[model samples]
Target chain A: MTDTITISVDAMGGDNAPRAVIHGASLALRERKNTRFIFHGRQEQIAPLLDEFPELRPASTVRHCETVIAMDEKPSQALRKGKGTSSMWMAIQAVKDGEADVAISGGNTGALMAMATFCLRPMKGISRPGIAAIWPTLRSDIIVLDMGATIGADAKQLVDYAILGSALARCLFDDDAPTVGLLNVGTEEVKGLDYIKEAGRVLTEASGSGFTYHGFVEGDDIGKGTVDVVVTEGFVGNIALKTAEGTARQVGSYLRSALKSNLMSRIGALFATSALNALRRKMDPRTVNGGVFMGLNGIVIKSHGGTDEIGYKSALSLSYEMARSRLIDKIGDTMQRFPIKVASEAPEAEPEANSA
Target chain B: MTDTITISVDAMGGDNAPRAVIHGASLALRERKNTRFIFHGRQEQIAPLLDEFPELRPASTVRHCETVIAMDEKPSQALRKGKGTSSMWMAIQAVKDGEADVAISGGNTGALMAMATFCLRPMKGISRPGIAAIWPTLRSDIIVLDMGATIGADAKQLVDYAILGSALARCLFDDDAPTVGLLNVGTEEVKGLDYIKEAGRVLTEASGSGFTYHGFVEGDDIGKGTVDVVVTEGFVGNIALKTAEGTARQVGSYLRSALKSNLMSRIGALFATSALNALRRKMDPRTVNGGVFMGLNGIVIKSHGGTDEIGYKSALSLSYEMARSRLIDKIGDTMQRFPIKVASEAPEAEPEANSA
Candidate 1:
């Protein structure tokens, strides 16, 4: 039998709170052969929900605490006041004490990032943390980094991001030497601001050594699966992620409206159930919702903002796989093996034929 | 009878270049009666294409201008050295000498923006120019501004962009009072940086004055048609525009690939043609190809980057509508009549609520 993979879940986070989180956790435990979940919130609030599931038994399954960081809370504030928050404290404490193999939350992203940085701290030889999200393009899936961790970043940071993203791909997707692509306005070597141009050179020169660095990719290629990993600054990444979600929602809504316009549309939809379902399965965000926070000491995946039960369950299951993969150590070791040389810190270093 | 609208098109621009541009122009002229097109390229080179059509019997038709700007040419250099280039000379001379009503080119965007800004300066009170694009959102088509021009803008500049975008809506879409929304991270009172926050305050305080200025809106709302005009800094605007294009392309490609997965998919597609076609029509970028360069003295529109004849034709039709609507003069007079009092430019001059 497999070892009991106990996990601490933030039951108070997400739009659907305890009910959704608890329901997902219990579902996860039931689905897996051997697993346990610690639901963190308040006793009075979470007790009834835990009791609702008789499969979980009397009440030893959930470990209640106090406080919750609302979705709208500023990230930094949540990190500072994390001690009082039951979800934050329980998650971090479980990991710290080795009681839980992983901690999962669909809380405010800013707060989660801040908490991860302050509590777990970065692995050795890492500066900034990045969010690794799976974008289902046409060819294959691409892991995009720094979705919203840091607002502004330099060229050196972006190069490092590429390295980190590549390393995470090795552990996650099992692509030992994954192809990395830099997200940019254009594909030219000299395109983008000085920051991006310099970063491209770094990625190009350092390619094949550790990471299989591709040249550049546009926003449309995010779902096309052109590359395994795409690296960009947090600001651009955040904008891209939000724009994709928004646009998809807009198109999906529009398509639904068009198809449900009248009796004719209803008739048309009847013949195309299989095709529509195929499209639905492919476009469903839950199919690729879990986004790993790279360069962190532990595995923490963010559930999509409007995540329902299926999406929440996907995040939890993804976290469990990540822990099984020994994700943290693999990324850390890969990074330690080939640390990036930053321009800001590597002053007076040998400049090998600057492409610029 | 409507006045004959004359247009100068850059034949040596875009991926398809002279061929696509020529076909697009011909289609526009053939389709519409009161529209005349002036092709700006080498006479000898265009002569063969003209011979094929044999419709250009009038000697005053095609303007003989040589030289072409490569897509990769540096923006500054292209703007400076391209004085004699076919596209540049045609656009400048056409607008400057009133030879053509407006100049349209799908050339290098940076160079186009520079030419448009330097040649056709903003109407009287306009400090900076903004590019307005029509987004096919859920509710209806909304005008998004500062899409490519004005990189890092202040609060008042964004407000100015909103006003310009609003005016474009009024002139083109015939919406008298377009609701303006500031593109932001969140909708909270203090969300985003100082520029966005201050812009929100101005937009909120200046409600019911000329255009209906709505509060801040998230990026996702772009597709919902929540607001008629969406304004943001050029960086964000450019990213948003690119993201949308990229996503639509990705979805289209993915559907094609999924439909070709196997015999089942192909067979499924056969039955799903009606539903799939309905989807294609809604997401097709061709239906909405023309993007207006707002806050300029004349009606200038930019076509798609990888656009073919269909997209180019759409741009031509849009240009015709702009000419028919007399958008430039109306917007120019509107701006002059109600000068938006920017806090920085006119801090001391506070016009009473009545004057607006």
Candidate 2:
């Protein structure tokens, strides 16, 4: 018998609410027959949506939750007001209570993170929790972490991110020893911040700790698939992710305009429609919808709040993969194997420098 | 009579060296008939390259400088060894001595910035110099500054960048009140670091000083052309620029593969050749090769070290425009008009938070 993987979902969270949530689960269930869903939200809204997918209705259980966290609610305020009864909180609580293998939410990222951390608590020895983004590259998908979960990570925290990110790569990529790289301005050893340099030193020393340290990688390397895992503080990671997305959209717009500019090109686009579809599928943000929250006791996937059913399904699939691979255990094991020792003295502060 | 714009060139700096420099100057001269060049490098190599374009020989004078700063050389080490005699140094020296209106180098970025600061010095109140790149956007070009000239800018420095970037935009875009935005993780007033928040508050009060403040903008807004100027510290700005470049290249690669995937697609590509060519031209990095050094005493341009003659020519043309527009004087005027007052007390530190 196939092992059941129960997913706790905050159904009333996203822009599309219970519709996308229930529809997404039905789509996921079609592919993964062993999955069951615990929907946490208003029973009235969720029950109607579940009826639309009779197959999903048989495998789903709706838990009543009166409070819904607003998309724009401050993390602190959301935690204060909706700590126990909110749908977002109940979804995460199901995972903590062992009722669900993992939790998925298409809600406020900050609120989801705050609730997840407050409920699940950070894994032993993990100081900061980070969100790992699965970035598409020329070779394959690479894991980039701390995508604006928090700002200003120290050297120790960066090293922690390295381990967390590597564990994520292992689960997603099915690699035992994934390669990790510290994101920097340049590939040179002497480039970037003090914390980055210190992280490099520690990662080098802890080379065989379930991941290979690929040294420093620049922003371009992220798209180039230079390493399996790329680690950085939240501030830089968030900007890099958004900047790439923007550039892709910008180029996509240019391509659309170019194809429509002339009669010949329009016919050409018709001829190349299938090929263009393949390209579109490759570049589509929906395929990479989930941002996995790492360094926590349980797995939580944050889907894009504005994404539709198709995008939410992608996030669900990722959650299934993570749960089946025992992602949290892997992270915990790596954390224990490679305990980061604080340096007695700070690394020498080098004068600020520029790179080409 | 057209005023002649003299450009100082680091002839033996780039990967192509003297040949690309001389050829580029000739190309620029063809367009802007009233232009002269001071080529600094090994005369023997430069003279032969200059002889290839006999028209350029009359408009150019070669200054023999034996030393050439290696692209990978440390900024401080390069300064210590090649201070006076390096081709890179002599190029900026010409600008300071008023022998040239602007200096253009495809040398080490760090070395160029160091020498430019040492030789020309910063403008009266500018603490840190920034490198501004002209980013191509949906609504034309927007200026993004501090592309890794230095890391970690204070609120005052960010304000200075706003003033400097606004001046460049005014000169290039020909709009007196160009809009400026602070680059952050989120556009919300409460998002990002204390320093960024402080800058936003100051910019709000100082709106219309020279440029109209548009509040905070995210990384995606850069490509959307949400504002005329996107001000960020060097570390984040540099990463964002490279990430965009990488994404564009990645998309271009994907497009090429898609068009060549099948026989019908290949035929379609042939039919839409001109439209495809136009798209290629728009996405070409050569069209935007120069990085303008702002907040400096004189105008300086950094060309991509790996770019060929076509790219080099683009940099030369940008130099001509800056000189004609009197970029330095415009910056000086804006800086004097709005002197940034330091905040009496540090802004309230907000708890670390996450953003979608």
Output the number of the lDDT-best candidate. 2
lDDT of candidate 1 over A1-356, digit per residue (tens): 14666667787878887777777766666677466777778778788876786676532366667778878876655655665455865686677567777788888776776676666666655666778887776676778888867655678778778877887777667878899887765624232266877887887877875578788776766766678988887766777787788887777676676667666556555555566677888889877777787776666677765677778777888777777777777776656666456654332211111210
**Residue pairs in clash, model 1:** A136-A223, A137-A223, A137-A224, A137-A225, A138-A223, A138-A224, A139-A224, A140-A225, A220-B246, B138-B223
- List ranges where model 2 is wrong by over 4 Å: A187-192, A343-356, B187-192, B343-356
Query: For residues A199-246, could you state the per-residue lDDT of candidate 2 as single tens digits?
Result: 889999998889999998889988899999999989999999999999
* Tens-digit per-residue lDDT, B1-356, candidate 1: 14888777777778887777777777777777678777787777677777765554342266777677777776666667676564655665686677777777877776676677666766666677778888888788888887756555678778778777777788766877788988876624221267888877777877666688788887777867889999887767777778887777776665576667666666655655676687887788887887787776676778775788878888888887877777776676556545347664332211111111
What TM-score does candidate 2 reach? Answer: 0.95
Tell me the TM-score of each prediction against the true structure. Answer: 0.88, 0.95
Each candidate structure's count of clashing pairs = 10, 0
Query: Residue A72 error for model 1, in Å?
Result: 3.1
Task: Give me the candidate number with maximum DockQ.
Answer: 2
Candidate 1 — which residues are off by over 4 angstroms? A1-4, A54-60, A76-82, A187-192, A257-268, A343-356, B51-60, B122-128, B187-192, B257-275, B337-356
lDDT of candidate 2 over B156-236, digit per residue (tens): 889989999999999999999999999998824233388999888899988988899999899999999999999998999
DockQ of each: 0.29, 0.57
